[model samples]
Target chain A: MKAEDVIRFCGRSLAGYPLRTGLMLLAMAIGVAAVVLLTSLGEGARRYVAGKFTSLGTHLLIVLPGRSETVGGPPPLLGQTPRDLTVDDALALTRSSAVRRVAPLMLGSAPVSLESRSREAIIMGTTADMFEVRNLEMAQGRFLPPGEVGRAEAVCVLGQKLRNELFGNGSPLGAFVRIGQRRFRVIGVLTKKGESLGTDLGEVALIPVASASALFNRASLFRILVQAQSREAIPRAKKAILQIIQERHEGEEDVTVITQDALLATFDRIFKALTLAVGGIAAISLAVAGILIMNVMLIAVSQRTGEIGLLMAIGAPGKQIQRLFLSEAAMLSLVGAAVGLLLALAGHWVLARLFPEFPLSVPIWSPITAVGVALATGLIFGVLPARRASRLDPVVALSRR
Target chain B: MIRLESIERIFQVGDERVFALRQVDLAVRSGEYLSIMGPSGSGKSTMLNILGLLDRPDKGVYQLDGRDATHLTDRQQAEMRRHKIGFIFQFFHLIPRLTAAENVELPLTLAGVDPVARKECVAAALARLGLAERAKHRPDQLSGGQRQRVAIARATIMRPALVLADEPTGNLDRASGTEVIHTIESLNAEGMTVVMVTHDPELGRRARRQVRMLDGRIVSDSGAGHEG
Candidate 1:
């Protein structure tokens, strides 16, 4: 028979039972929609995390006094005792060709009082190069002046929020704010930079490393931040820093050096695997839908035995009979897949609107794979019923009716 | 022309093998109107089914138009049935989902005839059967006689050489049954060979040639000058 005629015949038979047809379509559609929605969520989470890591800075590496066993895991609280990294070590590291700049960091908390407005705020102490290495912007006067390493000049830069709390619409440049029994002159106010790597950048105080070390009564630095001259220099810079730090600490190799690319790559691989896992879980629904199609088609074949016998008697061969039934299944799955795509699109749109901060969008391959799988499932599940229909004895079928 | 030689059909009932047809030999000319008459279980319907290629006898050599058809493959047999034979059933067997016109057009469609020619032929067949007005109505919407007319139109739509009718008027009222019988008689008069199976003795006698069957064997043949 002509292809068009086959489709027309199947269409007539399917239309005879509206409820059954609608139910099959619904099952297939829900299966496809579930796969799409879940995969989108998985893909969105991956993108969101990737964006967060990239914002920290590129071609950057951190040198911590304690070693981190895993690349991305948090530093152990009480691991093997490691040698302290001094400001001298950080300054010496800049001598390497791969290292473009170095910013020594020391963190502590101190109470600040400016005319009875006292707040215990976090204090981040580093040199003027900290602004360039960390991508910080200045809102007011100049940052800490260029000076000798570890010079004890008491100078500070206020975070945007701290500046507002201290001076409230008034300029605080060159004003002295007492921090930990020492007076410090404010030289600059930082432009607002929201949370990054779990630190509220906009609410802290920036001071000289030497002053913070003295106030906290410590000689070793908290960590050292390094920036490579170019992206290609990151590996060399990491090697050079480790060698330099080991040499300075009596060949102890106590510090852990992690590159920004290494951290980002770890996160990328983890999220990619997570996306595939969720997509695989969602595919189980497609299999369930396939089983449903088979069950319903079996019932349809038995119910239409008389009609099938009539066709056989009129000279339609077994292959033609199989094609007719298979075409019906194909039609149902195609329609269901189209509707599922529309549902997924609408779901994505609503999710993007509701959670604007999250990067919510499906990969192009999600819909394509969904369509391919849906068609394959329909054809595969259709075989059993079509074969049974073809094998029925026309004489017996007609006689029974 | 058609020929059947020593045809034997057996049915398994419990542990007993019942012979539905035994050693039956018959030959029919190209344009003959013949009828087979018998009571229930006499195998008249079985004989009609075998002649139409709807069933195969266990031991028989059947020929149609001089072709050795007893060993034809399933597909070859289907092709032969499509081009050379048509069937009309006692129940009419019109697909209830289709309108009268679509039901009549089914055979041509299965033969892959072009839409334009198929439409014209279906229209002509329905008009000839006086079903032009009811062409768009489904089988359920038509009366018993109208449904039978539609079946006849479908059976002859392909212009097959032989038409088989098994109790074609069995389910109709007397007036509708007479109308159906007249329609088949007209087709037969147009030089179409028709083989009908019926239990009505009067209807069986209307054919020019009649064969009577009893318990799996032909007891009498009018063409051979013997009456049971």
Candidate 2:
């Protein structure tokens, strides 16, 4: 038979039983939709994390005290220990030409009070360079004064939430707030910002690194934030900081330096694998849909035995009969894929509206792969039924009721 | 032209070989109108099936239009059937989903005839069968006589040289059966060979050549003496 005639015949056959065709299409559509929605979710999570990392400032490096790697050698008999990372070490990192600025962090929790209203807040002590390194924006007043790194300034900046709790929409700039037996003038109030890298910047207080060292009674710094002069300078700045820290600590190389690109790349790899795994799991539904197609097509063959016999008697080749049935399957799969894509798109729109902050998006290749697999499964599963129809004895088939 | 030499067809019924046709030899010249008449289970339908290429004879040298059809490949047989043979059935096996015109167009469609030519041929065929007004009606909507006429139109749509009818009037009423038989007679009169299988003695007598079979063997043939 001609190709168009075969297609028209199969289309008419499928359209003859609307309920059966509809249910089959539904099964295939759900299979494809599940793949798209689940993969989009995994991809959305990946992008969300990547976005958070990007917001931490480009060409950045973080230095933490203590070596993160394990050494295989035995301990020295003299009891050698890794020294602490201090403000001096943080300052020494600025000597390199590739290093743009550095912020040495000191963290502590203390109660601040103004006229009997008291709230315990996390206090982060850093220098004025922290305003640029951490990408902080001031809602009012200026940031910490740029001066000596060790200068114990009696002024501090309050986070948005902390300022609201301490002052309650009143002007908090220049107001003295007592903290840990010391009074400091509020130099600035931070703008509203969300969590980044597990830290809620909206709820902490900022102070001079020297004053936090005195108040907490610890010389060890928490972390050092290093901003490279350019994107290409990140590795150079990291090497210089590690070398400088090693020299200051008697060549121990105790500090761990992490570049933003390396961290981002690690996260990117993890999420891509996660998306693929979830997508693979979702593909199982498509296999089930394929099986459903096979079952339905088998039933269709038996149901139309008389028609098949008639065609055979009218000189339709077995191969032509097979082509007719296979094209029916292909048409079903194509329409089902289209419906599934629409369902996935609608689902994505709803989810994006529900969670606007998440970078929810379907991976570009997912739809193409889902549709390809669907078509492949349909054709593969269609083979048995088409073969069965072709192999039927026309005499016996025509005799059937 | 059609020839079958010593055709033998056997059926296995619960492990016992039963002969449907035994040593059945028959020859039909072009444009002949012949009918095989027998009781049920006498292999009349089997004879018709073998003639139509729907069944393969176990032992026979069947030739059609000077070609050895008995040993042809399945594809070659299908091609031969498409170009040279047509079939009519007792049940009026018109595809119910199709209109009467599409039913008549089936043979040409299967032959890969293009739509414009197919439509023209179908219109002419249906019109020749006196079914022009009923072309748009489905099989269920048409009466018994009209349905059989549609099947006749379908059978001759490819203009085959030979037509096989398996009890074509078995399922119709008397008037419809007479009308269908007349349509087959007219086609035979136009120089197309017609072979029909029927149990009705009255219907069997209308053909120019008559064949009677008993127990898978031909018992009598009116035209055998003249051919010999």
Candidate 3:
């Protein structure tokens, strides 16, 4: 058929049953909008979590203590329970070709004192490599060296928040401080690294790991934090580290290796499942829209049986009869898809405005899927009625009063 | 040529089959004008329907140009109706949604005649029917005489070999009825065969050959033999 004829047919589609077409489009639009809006929100939450983790030096790894041995619970790996990683382990990992830096991380809360001011602060103890491992830069003085570490120097680097609380933005470097009854000199203050994953990074102080071990006096190791040269070497470095750690433990495996890729894959699966759930729920309403289209088209077939017969008697072939009606149905679906796209866009725009940090991510694929669904819906649901129209015996139909 | 042999048309109202036409034989030569007349249930409409190919006789051989048409598929019969046979109904069945010219133009359109040629033919038919001025008016807008003339224009637009008009003027008064009959007869004069069914004896007698049906059978056939 010519383009004009196709356009004319679509016009007929609208004029045939304006109310029904309007209602079906509305149903599709509302359903699509809700799906897009809710899915975007979920995506935004995932993005925010990923962003927080990304801020703490994308390469940093946290290793926790192995499980404690209980009476009848999980078995120990490496033939040991609650195995403690030591400073030597961190040093061993750094020697690998892929390894860029390593830091033994020790964390505890301590009441920090400066002048007459004292505030409870989260304290981190690590080698000078912690600066490179975390991509951390000091706002004042230098990080303590290995000489200072070996001597167990009474010097500390204060986090920006702790420094500000003690001295209100004035230079706090070279100030005297106390942690757990031990006097220390504040040799440096760290550039502000704000809250991450809801843990305030600003309220912290750094010292030598040996000094921390001496001060805390609880020598069970925490974890060895390591960074590889690049993301490409992370997995290889991890594998080598695991093997070495294994060799050190007499070939007994205790540590679990994790990567950002693995974690992201899990998130992908989770989001995918959520997408299916959302799409499935959206499709229920779409199914209702399909039913509405079908019911109306069926009623239309019955009503136009005579008209169909008249056309057939005049020489319209069975296929043409089927095509005309089916075209009408398909046009309805396309209209629905268009309206659905608009509604989805509108919903996304409104939601994105409400939360600046939460981005409403509109994937181009979702609307394309909706359009495909509508087309399939038209063909599937419209076929039966179009067939009915095509199958009507012209003689009987035309003879009707 | 048109011929009907041993025609029987049985209708099942509910349970029993009633033969609307039984052992009915009739014919009309090419270009002949004929009318079949009978009471309501006496099978006049049945005869018209069979001759028109709008229906098939239950037990008979129907020939158009000596081709047995009774065995043709429904689509083939519809094509025959489209290109060779035409119908004019009493109610003036002019497709209320279409203008008079469009209704007149429908048969040619269905035949897939080129649009420009179809338009020329439609214009010629309208001029012949003297409805050139009323072509744009829909059936509801056209007067009785005008609508019947439009219907006649539609029937003859294809220059079909046969025109089956069932009570074409049964719904019109004499002045309008005469105009419609004249329009149809003019086509017959131009060598198109016309077979009409009507209740009015005066109208029935106007045809060159007259058929009288009674009790599901032909009672008399005048002015010609049983083959055309």
Candidate 4:
């Protein structure tokens, strides 16, 4: 048969049973839409986390006290206590040529009261270099003054939310605020940064590292942030910090150094796998759709047995009959896939409008993969019914009606 | 021309083997009109199916146009049917979804005839069958006589050498039956070999040659001596 005639014949057959054809198309379309939307959600989450990491500043390394071993068991309750990472260790990291700057962190919660207004806020104690290392911006006044690392400067930078709570809309810079038992002047106010890593940057108060040690009455630092000279210097800077800490602690590698690339790479791998797994789960629906096509096609073969017999009597080969049915299936799948792609895109658009901050997008390969798998499913599942129709006994078929 | 020799067709019903057609020998020349008449289960339909190549005989050497047709492959048999044979059925087996013109164009379309030529042929055939105005009407919309005429148009659209009709007017009223009989008779008058199977003695007698079957055997043939 001519290709166009075959198509027209199949088209007429499908159009003859509108309800059955529409339901099958709906099933196939839902399967494809599910795959594309779920994968896009997974990819969106991956990009969101990656964006957060990029905002944590480039070529950075985090140094924390004690090794975090991932053994397949519960952590030891009475594990060996590692040496404390001090402000001296932070100063020692600055000597490496690969390291651009180091900011030692000391975290503690304290009540900050300005006159009668009081609220408990997290205190972040770091050096002046922290503003550059952590990508913090100043909304008013200047950041911590660049001076001696050990100087116990009685000055602080209030977070945007903290300043709002303490002084409302009024300027809080240069005002004295009592944190715990000591009074410090608010030297700067941070911009309206939201969340980073897990910390709400808009809710903390930044203070000098030495002043935090005196206020919290501890010599040990919480963690150290090191910035490498360039993207390629991150590994070298991590090694230098580890070696410096080990040497300072009398030949013991007590501190764990993690680079930004390593952390980002780990998250990247995790989310990619998650996307593929979700896409795989959605593919099961496509298989179900394929089975539906097979079932319906089988019914169609039986329902149109008389018509098939007529074709055979009029000189259609068995192969032509098979092609007719197979092309019907292929046409259904192709149009269904197209409709599904449109559905997914519309879903993405609606979701993006609802959550504008999220990086909502459909991955390029998802549509291609969905359509390809849909076509394959149609053909593969179509084989049985087509073969049955082709092998029908025309005489017996014609005698039925 | 068509020839059949020692044809045997068996059916397995429960534990017993039933003979549908036994030792059937028949020869038909080009452009001749003939009819086979029999009661229910007399193997007349079986003969038509075997002659139409819709069924295979258990033991026979069948030839059409001097070519061995009994053992031809399924594809080759379909090709032969495409170019050399036409069929009209009792219920006028027209696909309900297609229009009269499209249904008539089926054989030519399957033969890969170009759309323009196919359209012209279908239109001419429909016009010739007195269904020119009903060409765009579906089978369900056409009257019984009109539907049978559409089937006739379809059967002759391929310009086949032979036409086989198995009770073509079996389901129609008296007037429609007479109309359909006249249509096929006209095709036979135009030098196309026509073989029809029917239960109506009146219709069977209208053909120049008549064969009567009983219990899977041909009991009588008026044109027995005219075999090619």
What overall lDDT goes with each candidate model? Answer: 0.87, 0.91, 0.76, 0.92
Candidate 1 regions off by >4 Å?
Answer: A70-80, A108-123, A135-195, A200-220, B224-228
Model 3 compared with the native: what TM-score? 0.78
Worst 10-residue stretch by lDDT in candidate 3 chain A? A62-71
Q: Tell me chain A's TM-score in each of the predictions.
A: 0.85, 0.94, 0.75, 0.92
Candidate 4 per-residue lDDT, tens place, A1-401, comes to 88999889989999999999999999999999999999999999999999899888878899999988554866558766899999999999998999998999999999998999998999989999998999989999999999998999999999889999999988897899999999999999999877898888888888999999999999898999999999998878888888999999998678888888998999999999999999999999999999999999999999999999989989989999999999999999998889898888889899999998889878999989999999999999999999999999999889877
**DockQ-superior candidate, 2 or 4:** 4
TM-score of every model? 0.89, 0.94, 0.78, 0.94
Candidate 2: TM-score of chain A is 0.94
Q: Summarize candidate 2's per-residue lDDT along A1-401 as a digit string, tens digits.
A: 68788778878888989999999899889989999999999999999999898888778899999888787988668965678889999999999999999999998999988889998888888999999998888999989889998989999998888899989979998899988888999989888877889888888888999999988999888899999999999989988998999899987888899999999999999999999999999899999999999999999999999999988888988888898899999989988988999999999999999988888889999999999999998999999999999999989988874
The segments of candidate 4 whose C-alpha lies over 4 angstroms from its true place after superposition are A70-80, A113-117, A139-141, A164-178, A181-188
Mind giving the per-residue lDDT tens digits that candidate 2 earns over B25-62?
88899999999999999999999888888889999889
Q: Which residue runs of candidate 2 sit more than 4 Å off their true CA positions?
A: A76-82, A112-119, A138-141, A161-191
- Residue B6's lDDT within candidate 1 is 95
Error of 3 at A379 (Å): 1.8
Clashing pairs in 3: none
Say which candidate scores most in DockQ.
Answer: 4
Query: Of 1 and 3, which scores higher on lDDT?
Result: 1
Clash counts per candidate, in order, are 0, 0, 0, 0
Quote the chain B TM-score of every prediction. 0.97, 0.98, 0.96, 0.98
Model 3 segments more than 4 A misplaced: A1-10, A24-61, A67-92, A103-224, A243-254, A284-287, A351-369, B91-105, B116-152, B169-179, B225-227
DockQ of each: 0.66, 0.66, 0.30, 0.82
Residue A322, model 4: lDDT of 96
